[model samples]
Target: MTTATTASDDVRLSAREAAERHLRALVGRDDAVLREDQWAAIEALAVDRRRALVVQRTGWGKSAVYFVATKLLREGGAGPTVIVSPLLALMRNQIAAAERAGIRAVTINSTNIDQWQPIHDQIHAGEVDVLLVSPERLNNPGFRDEVLPRLAATCGLLVVDEAHCISDWGHDFRPDYRRLRTLLAELPTGIPVLATTATANQRVTDDVAEQLGVHADGTSDAAVLVQRGTLDRESLRLGVVQLKTPEQRLAWLADHLAEQPGSGIVYCLTVAATQEVAGYLRDRGLEVAAYSGQTEADERHALEQALVEGRVKALVATSALGMGFDATLGFVINLGAPSSPVAYYQQVGRAGRGTDDATVVLLPQAEDRDIWAYFASLGFPREEQVRETLAALAESDRPLSTATLETRVELGRNRLESMLKVLDVDGAVQRVQGGWVSTGRPWTYDAERYARVAEAREREQQAMLGYLRTTECRMRYLREQLDDVGPDGRAADCGRCDNCGGVTLSSAVSDASVAEAGQRLSRPGVVLEPRRMWPTALGNLGLDLKGKIAAGAGPGRTVARLTDLGHGQALRQLFREDTPDGPVPPGLAQAVMDVMKDWSSQWSSRPDAIVVVESATRPTLVNDLAEGLSRVMQVPVVGTWAIRDPSVPPRAGASNSAQRVAAVRRRGGLDADVPPGATVLLVDDQVATGWTLTVAAVAIREAGAGAVLPLALATQG
Candidate 1:
């Protein structure tokens, strides 16, 4: 609540006027004026040289505050502004906006690694006024060791975009963002800093503001300005559609997507669902494209442009398209519910940015909780795994790369890397040139804190479910979830939601459309690409495997991915621990046969024999699959590989590739003799890491099989 002491009244007013002029230039409108709070924020940063956090709605001109402050500060002889952004899409949009305002802006991100050196040169040469870098770049060994120190010392203003990610309590917490505390500690005392986010609740807001208030000497100033506005989006009309099945949901979209006012986004919970929904919509003669983290960078850019320019009807996407993607999208439809209401609010905020009224609808399906549970399994690892990682790092004479560390720990590559980032931020480890090194600093496990976070996440999930069935005002519920307190200390109801008697979406869908959707979804198969190379550093695990693997298995086929919209439901039910072991059901049997009928045509040679990978959990299902395929394809059942040991507990899962491979090699071997150079069919009930199939195929090939055409009932996409 303290004002900047250095700026007098007249000087602050003059700076405020200059900021408005900059805003007018940026928006290309002479009449454009800064909102009261925006001016207050810019005044604090530009004139007062103090830290501030702006928690405003998505379209409330938070970017304008920073851009204007950057311009005014640079004019007063401050150095270039360093903005730590989260997404490439956001960086692109900011660069474009900076150009429109005649401010020189450049970016350093994964997509433009070749341009980073020149960008750094421009910043050093005083030619660039603004620099945008991803938070992940803050931990890069070269950047952290070489460029970041200079940037921190010389940057005029530090802007943290999407700052909610810096808080572990936030819905979309990122480990790399924890590095911000280190960066903050390096900044000079009087250098201005601005952190902006549209999605932070009270807890996230307080967390970020506390970090912002820290000084170079490790003391908190308590003078950081926190300006939080209402979280309501006036142009969004919210509603929900409760559907019984995935087929009916797709039918609803197929029936109603084109009817939306303008081009928009259709969101799904999983990548496989994105592809499935986009493909089905396109087959229904709608113009759309599937977008996710798995999409190529070039294609993502093209698809984004298509949506912005109204070239495509919509982009069926996952959370990949969530933060800071700017478009005048007229509608946003969710194929499934997100696990957290805060995250849901952020995604839906992408729409109605430039429109009078945007359609926002949630189509909640029956399988959403299952998807939530699957994602929950990927949260923070157990304490033993973290201890093991630290122990390995402490024992190594030299820094071990993530791949090398993976060979020592039982964690997967992604999860292990994430845990290391958090530890680095906590002073338990440090990232050096080659890899990570133990800092020898004492650190607590913080089991109670982790438990509290888990409890919070559970509450958020249950609240999201309640959202689907709530009778109160939908918009008010969302705002309250974000802790948005208005001037009256309460979130008021918007008269536009379905529960509030606004424009209600039709619940009726054509019988023909539903039938078509069901038929299309029932047709299930996913092409499984074969692993061409073995995981690195297998020698550490007493295996000689490395380098490009010899071709033991060709491309394979699975009935469906567990994330798919069609037979995925059935597969999920069948794989549940409570589900009893039995033969393959009639519907799934037909699906497997159908997959075989289509997949066999793509093979170079038909299989002469079938080999089953024994499943300890579902032996009957795997045996029945092998026998049925043997009868149908006229291929003999030649062998069985007991990869799943009964004595070894499955409590600790094998998500890591090297771990799975080592376990399979220990217990798996072909038992039946094979004809030399004869084609073989490998059957399994499910393919998770795919190591069982790969290892089994290698052993079968060593047994003199010509080619392995592996088939599975489902895949864990």
Candidate 2:
């Protein structure tokens, strides 16, 4: 994290200047256009010979730095510069840029494999200048056996782009990057190696260098370039919105689009959710496109073209669309909280590239709260997990199924898979024929040293995660991590995050009040009595009803009458008639009525039916009421229902009579035939943050349901 130290006194022109003058003359350049800082970094790279890790933030022009180093060594009569990039599109872009700069560059990828032989011949003949290859392409035996040997014979400059992939701590870790160290070992010493990434922090930089075998004492003289004092476009305003329902979220997005009609991307957590959101947007009269891993290449290309041509104003996507696809997007909206800070930054960076002003909006859900909590609980996977994952992968001779690993390791399937992917990127294992296999080498300085380093790296990752979950200035955190503290010793307030804007709920109130309110409304015995008075006992008490009321079922069904105020003529009438054993006490009815009224006003903006139960009420009152309402209203419930306390755990021969009836009601029961193109209604007992309903709605749409509506007894605002 240390900044580059400067010389105390400048020497006018020394022996080094004379040698540089000669070298520049041979390279056909009169002067090095690189800034002093860049030149110092380049000189360090040239002197150090080992791999150089450069952690430069956005707009620092990392590509230019590496290009200059490549030219210096290649033009100085060294070997052809070999650059391993991550994406084929990026390879093409870099090669095109190089060619435009009048530098000879060639790329070997899927499309132009036919030209690979000629490129190989040129490199071996020492006629090629810079050779760009995808990591996947580098793993090809044809290139490894033939072209690599020639390149090794005349080793010059080796450059790795998206170098963070070499570290387990990186967001976009790739397995191909792990084999890079072994590949480099095949070449001779004295060949200067450079690794460049825009997002790597100190931990990532150190791990990447170690993985590449660039550090001898596990210490690297890596330089971190912080793009401090730059304004992130005045046009771009970051905002966060808290929503309680899927319908509200959709309506909000529609309003947002109406206000700003431009190209944008909506990032979702899952492919299925992306598709659902895209459909919902389209239905709402917006030109929308969707992309995910499951999407066909041609379809994705067409979507991309549509967005670029202004034919589609919005795109819903998973993270399948990666770092290098440069689009002139107007906004980037995250539908749920990102799992990591690096992911959040990368996705948000997609917007505001060309627009005068753009926006990055985060719509967090309750499910995402679990995601953060899970991350907090595990923090980062411990060193033991890493070692176990590696040892298991090494033991497997073939590409091991993630499910198998999960069973054996006793780790959650998703977590285990993520860790395995990280290990694969660090070069400890490879996805073999059918399972993971050992790469026959450890990532760092044996087991003990690696364990220590792994523990330290985990702590850093946990700290970063905590920072991301904070409601503070994100830009300030970035600056602090890069060691560029402000003059006032305090980062500038962003005035955007949930914390700064005072949008977050107080811990005490959010934890106790919302849950208690939701519980009162959704409780099994809760009943709503009709009210016909304004400013009555319930109204005077300032109660709001927020949960569902269960009514009895039979030929003459009991009603759960909703009221603005629970204490009124309706409650008095019900007590006087229904409770005949004694003269119904006014005080008790008024108190219960007050709670009901408060719950209703707090939940539903409008009043409706009062929940009146017959003499009999079942254990699953909520489910029964939901089923009865769906039948009565003839609306299909789009998701599954849970009976909180089943009489008995479902046995092999037990009949699902309740389930059958519910399914019948869901498909439009005997009461009414299924309406043509009727929208589906998803019913739930209670909602904390509406994430379950959102997911259920998406599933309904995917199942060919015409429209989806969520019906719940209670919800958290």
Name the top TM-score candidate.
1
TM-score of 1: 0.98
TM-score of each: 0.98, 0.55
Model 2 RMSD in angstroms? 15.9
Off by more than 4 A, model 2 = 1-51, 109-118, 125-128, 137-155, 184-187, 209-236, 305-311, 354-356, 370-474, 477-484, 487-490, 494-717
| Tens-digit lDDT track of model 1 for 145-240 | 899899988999999999999988998899999888888878876788899999988988999999887766778868899999989998999999
lDDT string for model 2 (505-602, tens) is 22122333344333322222123222112111121123331122121111110122221011222332333324433322344323433443444343
Clashing pairs in 1: none
Residue 548's lDDT within candidate 1 is: 90
In candidate 1, stretches whose alpha carbon ends up further than 4 angstroms from where it belongs are 1-3, 486-489, 643-645, 650-653
Q: What lDDT score goes with residue 348 in model 2?
A: 73
